[model samples]
Target: MRLSLNPLAFGTAFALALCTSAALIGSGPAAACEGRTTLAQSYVGANKDVKAEYVYCANDLRSDVSTSTGAGSDIFARQNDVCGAACTTYCWTPSGGGPDPNDCTVIQDALLYDSENTGPLFSLDPATNTSMIVMTYNTCQTYILDQTNSSLTYCRSDWATLVNYIAFNCQATQNAHGGVCVADDQRWYIQVQHS
Candidate 1:
């Protein structure tokens, strides 16, 4: 089951998930957007503790939000993609299609960019069953709270550097997993930036 998400849902659900129980934890990107072709780079050893799971705002194909209420399943929030000033996370797969509409456990912030203006930074090749996912961490917080988060700052202001950082970490992760992370019939490739 896949789900598209938004920050508003996470912000609103934060209290609910917290008050619910401790069992809520653990969960689980890519494709569509053909402006760039980025493959997984070598992962960094010093940054192994780094998390490479939040990559929203990269749009090639678009979808609405769904709920996947699971333990620790929020994809985290950020804004930059479709929600405009609002926030949303989009979880979609070419095969299974869009996510279940009621799932809110997975969170990824939406963005507001004219598909006509921005070209594409990533793309999904269904033939190879591969997708290059570009991620921005803490992006929504930076947008909403104006907090000092390095990842968000880097992503909002300087994207090239952020993309480089993401590529390096992605390589490192792929190295650990034999140069690939596979699920279903797809092989996932990633690029990301964070604090």
Candidate 2:
């Protein structure tokens, strides 16, 4: 009897081994977004065109404000106080400026927190997956919040720098794991993942 090895099976196994090794090494790109630290670091490291400060903004502060209890208005108003004159209540209005729901308050609060902190703010959420990162560049800032169990990545601004930063970081991280990143409707999707 003769023994033969299947090329396809062998190749798949080899790729899996490589991925497992890469993850274990811990020196290469992360296997997934994981948390705010990984996301913030990757974004800042991969993007150099924008001179910005990136930091993690845990959802604790936002969590206390209940959108269902009609506290959203109070919360937004407080955020507006933080943002001062730059904040606008009609961020989603067509006549205001496009359809981005993230207003100046969101960006300003993130930037303000970044300026006051030395490092990323750790999340208290049990999942530890729902987190955000604030990137402040020039006069404007934006938020990149990761959705739980969703491939749809959201960014606050339409600025080219902000958009490119997210796309570049997502693609780079996914590529390291043998995946492809695609951007559509301001959301990034990873089409493939290493088996």
Candidate 3:
């Protein structure tokens, strides 16, 4: 007799494997439903874990999505639109700065002179700020807004640590422009207009 199993069994196994990989990739506290769009889909965030993946359903596929990692809100809305099945992921770390002397000042000067107008890593609203920028010099961090005291803050432990790293290594003056940190809580959030 030949050993042949039902096709359904193979399909189920495949699905389970995919789910397992997705889970390993860092989904949210909840697992995503089969074929359903959700925030828990694999994706990357502004975290120190370089192996992290920023995955999610397409904007056309899902109106909401997020991940366990802490990424920038400025990027999240765009991620929904372009996060392929596997999602966009990358590894990044700051380097090449002095030991001290003028840490924040060095970074602030770079921001003002670099022509990029980088950002303010700190925030006035902790609840809203989820990401922090890297500092190039002594690396003392600051913010355009101070989220260290906000109500909507949802950043995770690792995320908070990452932000702290940015703050300590960057400049407070940089926080005066378009690049402000927004805290992500592993849950999909909708963009709200400011008054």
Candidate 4:
């Protein structure tokens, strides 16, 4: 006769499987907003002229205070008591769908205008199931004090550059990937299927 297996083993195995699945699913876009095309509503303005990620302030510094959690004040206090009168807050807000019919050519034209100074436009066919991701490097620093040593050190601001990089490439890549559509790093992809 076969020995009865322990119930605890089965429960543990099942829990492990569930956790693994959840981790994988969570890694991608959130379900609430997944598959819903999102447009870049930047502080600068929406790029309705071109089918591109809207330029939000374009590296401009913030004119007023942002967070009140004292993060800004703390950062300012440590930095030689100088947060400066004009500090920048680089960010994007979710708007609506990707580019419309006229967006494709418009964006291309805009890129052409800046072609002299920008990188080559990366494109891929939607049928290929690949995306062109843009990337860049930036550095910003705010001093912080250590509780144990009571010394200050520079914190990283690399994320600012990464945000800009995503905004730069996401639209073009999505346009190419979505059968000539628009998309962003937030995975807001909208496909305008060809007739």
Indicate which candidate wins on TM-score.
Answer: 2
Please tell me which predicted candidate would have the highest lDDT against the true structure.
2
Model 3 regions more than 4 Å off: 1-76, 79-101, 116-134, 139-195
| lDDT of candidate 1 over 1-195, digit per residue (tens) | 999787534533542232221211111132334444444432211222212222232333321121223311234223212111211112112222212211101112122121113332323332332333233233211111111111111122122222222222222222211011112111222122122
lDDT scores for all predictions? 0.23, 0.28, 0.25, 0.24
Between prediction 2 and prediction 3, which has the larger lDDT?
2
- Ten-residue region with minimum lDDT total, candidate 4: 140-149
Off by over 4 Å in 1: 1-28, 34-60, 66-158, 172-195
Per-prediction count of colliding residue pairs?
Answer: 36, 0, 44, 3
Point out where model 2 deviates above 4 Å: 1-39, 42-47, 51-55, 62-126, 144-152, 155-195
TM-scores across all candidates? 0.20, 0.23, 0.20, 0.19
> TM-score of predicted model 1?
0.20
How many backbone collisions does model 3 have? 44
The TM-score measured for candidate 4 stands at: 0.19
- What residue pairs clash in candidate 4, if any at all? 61-88, 62-87, 62-88
lDDT of 2 at 7: 51
